[model samples]
Target: MRQAPVSLPLGIVVRRTPSVSRWAPWAYKAVSVIPGAGAADWQVLREDGDVIEYHAATVPLELWHTDTEAYLAGLSARVPSIGVVMRDDDESAHPYEILLATASPYECQDYADSGEELLELVPMPEGLVALIRDFVEEHHEEEVFVKRRRDKKRIDEVEDGRGDPRITQLTDVYRAPRAGRPN
Candidate 1:
C-alpha cells in the first residue's frame, strides 16, 4: 500500500533500558511487519529537567499489513501492552539519559500550550489498556475524607482499621432515635 504522510500530535515519551541483544532492534522490526506500520515513526528527543531520556513515536495501528484490530490482537498474545514516555525539549537539559516508563498514553493537545514539546509516541497492544483500566478501577476511589485520631480509645482499639469508630457517636450527637423515642 502507498504510504500516506499522517502526523499525530506528539504525546508521551518513554524510556526503557532496551534489552542488550540483537533482539531489541529485531523486536521493533517484527512489529513493523504489520501493515501500516511504516506510517508510525519515532525520534529521540531531549529529556525533562529530571534528566529522564525520552523518545517519541507514532502509535502503530497496523500489523503485518493487517487491520489495526487484528494487529492489536496478535500483539496482545505476546505483550500485555505497549508503553510510551513524554517530555518537553525546551524544558530539559542536553544529553539527558534517564528512561522512565509512562503509566499511560498522553494526549498531545493536552500540552500544546507548552510550545514545541518533544513527544515519543509508542504503540501499545489493546491488552495493556485492559490491565491499566483494571488497575485504576481497583486502586482509585472517591469517598469522604476524615482525619484519624492520634489517641487510641478503647472502642478504637477494638474496631478494625476499615472505618472510624467515632462515626456512630458523631451520628448520635447530631440526632438520635428522633430524640423523643422510648428508652
Candidate 2:
C-alpha cells in the first residue's frame, strides 16, 4: 500500500528595503532608507500540531512522493532561502501582484525579477526545517549518483558499414555529369 502524502509547514521571511521618494528634496530626506535594513515578517501559512503550532503566519507545504527528493535538495542548501514572489508596484499601479515564494534555486533563477519584486534570502525557521527533515526522512529516498560509461565498439580499418567511404566511391565520374542529366 502507498503511504498518503502529507502537507508540511514552511516558514517565510520577507525583507523590506527602504528607499527615498523619487522627488525627495536633497536635505529633508538626506538619510534614505538603507537597503537590506528593515523589519522581518514571519509567516507560516499552515497550522499543524506542535510543529505548525507556532502562532505565526505560515503556508502549508504539500510534498508528493516524487517531489520529496527535489524539495529536500533545496532545503539542503547551506543557506536555505525560500523564494518569495512579491510584486513591486512603486513605478506601476499594481499592488500586491507578484510572485510570492518559490521552493528551489532552479525555480528562483527562472523567476522574473523586476525592481518591484522583492527577493530575500531569509533563513528557514528551525521548526519548519525540522518538520521538513522528518518528512524527508520518512518519504525521501536518496538517489545515488552514478557515472555512466560509454559503450565501446570495435573500429574496422576498411569497408565499414555507415562510416565506409568505399561504398560511396564514385564509379563513373565522366558519365555522372555534375549538373547535366539524371544519373
Model 1 TM-score (2 dp) = 0.24
- Estimate, for each residue in 1-183, the C-alpha lDDT of model 1 and write its tens digit: 653422222233444344558754311211211112222233445444433333434343211221233323324444433333234333444222223233332332333345544333345535545544444444444445898877664563432233454685423443324346674
Give per-residue CA lDDT, model 2, range 1-183, as digits (tens). Answer: 776656544433332223356663211111111112222233233344423211122344455566676667778799665565554446653233334444555555556444445454445556656766776787777779999987786565443223444456546333324455575
RMSD of 1: 18.7
Question: Per-residue lDDT for 63 in model 1?
Answer: 18
Give the number of the best model, judged by TM-score: 2
lDDT of 2: 0.47
Over 4 Å off in model 2, which ranges? 1-5, 8-17, 20-60, 87-94, 98-100, 112-118, 146-149, 154-183
TM-score of each: 0.24, 0.47
